[model samples]
Target: MTAITINFNNVLKLSDDQFYQLCRDNPDVKFERNAFGELIIMSPTGGETGKCNASMTADFIIWNRQTKLGEVFDSSTCFKLPNGSDRSPDVSWIKLERWNALTSKQREKFPPIAPDFVLELMSPSDSLSETQAKMQEYMNAGVKLGWLIDRKTRRVEIYRQGQQKEVLESPTSLSGKDILPGFVLDLLFV
Candidate 1:
């Protein structure tokens, strides 16, 4: 199923704490909030998508471990963006310095910073338009690099700050470029 969005602005608006509590209260649900205060309920990925996500996340973790330049986070970790939106990418990374700047309490809850890099792997249930919009949101929130990968179409859209997006078709791999020097994502698994 595709994601379902609900607008509660007319009835009640959830504060940051309340949104956290809502997520905590519903452990089984994957939730996201738009800058307009609409709640998005996302469906869980299928087996193939899950496996691909795990592999991609593992690659990021291994790369981060070797470089020690950033912290890698899986899909479950959400960040509060500058535009009042709360989003969780399939995989995300924050530079070491940026991550270290967060206070303990801030780190304990949703991180109040945009990830330096983000990757979104499309699942059967995902809408391309919606996912692209989300990527734009990330860029607007100061994400330096982002990737939208569609395995079905063997397409990759690369987003960089202050530059036009580049689309690659059936590429064998992806480069991390300046943002993640020496890091390359092998698309074979996808």
Candidate 2:
């Protein structure tokens, strides 16, 4: 169930509008774009992964609701990154001020900014190397904090801006640290 990647570096490159239209026309296939304009097609995750994704998304949503700090986005929300890639993290959040900077139309379409925080949960179909690369891309695109959670391994890779990635094994919880003050992720279920 590994995701397929189509290299478009030599092929005809899709324009931003064309890519948007392609996504809109094909609602069933999940697609992503790399900085090199390569197309990534991913299949739907299995039930276990779906449940885990939902629970983690709910955690971020609840925190955002309580703090009113920023906008929270689920996996379906794609972002046009500064590097020209289109990515969708499992759970993402942006600072209120930064989000406010975008106009209504910008908000209506795929957001044109990287999130302040991003989270990715590994599914059975996902490859660890590919996921790690994606997390690195997030950091390079201005994500302040990112987490790569592998439920099967019960481990988490913490990625922070201008810092080395830290791997934690079998942790029961994760702190938001300075990036997400007063927030913590209970990973008991994950």
Candidate 3:
């Protein structure tokens, strides 16, 4: 089979529902828009490209969930930011009761709400400025907590409501103090 060449300049259009439905059929595709509406498609990172780093993120979220603490979502989905923009975080968690507050339809939509916490790990192709901007947007939109995980640096930039930005390295615990009680993410070594 011939490889498909992606022309980033071309416009890619889809309604929010179209994008959600696409996810069900093709979990391997990742979508993002440029300044224009062109939806850039790339194979979702996996195997070696998505190895240790992404899995570390998964491990953290899973630990929280298995402890029956929260629900987690990965980059296989997108979200509506309060500023009327859309974004995809590497991993996120919604406090159980708050998430269950959604109507069936609301749950089916773009989740119309922010996660109690979000974790974004840098892929090889991700840009620092872009990822940081995303974390800021999430916080400004009332997201209680956010983490920008640097795979290459093995650190995370932690964000919280009404606080200064703090970069944490190893041996520090990632906490959801206000948003998630009894939650401590000890992912320094990861």
Task: Name the top lDDT candidate.
Answer: 1
lDDT of 1 by residue, 84-172 (tens): 99999999999999999999999999999999999999999999999999999999999999999999999999999999999999999
- Number of the top TM-score candidate: 1
**Which candidate would rank higher by TM-score, 1 or 3?**
1
**Residue 42's C-alpha lDDT in candidate 2?**
87
What root-mean-square deviation over C-alphas does model 3 reach?
A: 4.4
lDDT of each prediction vs. the true structure? 0.97, 0.93, 0.68
Error of 1 at 101 (Å): 0.3
User: Which segments of model 1 are wrong by more than 4 Å?
Assistant: none
What digit string (tens of lDDT, one per residue) describes model 2 on residues 1-190? 8999999678789998899989999999999999999999988999999999999889888988999999899999999999999999999999999999999999988889999999999999999999999999999999999999999999999999999999999999999988888889999958
- For candidate 2, which ten residues in a row score worst on lDDT? 8-17
The residue pairs in collision within model 1 are none
After superposition, candidate 2 runs with Cα above 4 Å error: none
Compared with the true structure, model 1 gives a TM-score of: 0.99
- Which is the winner by lDDT between candidate 1 and candidate 3? 1
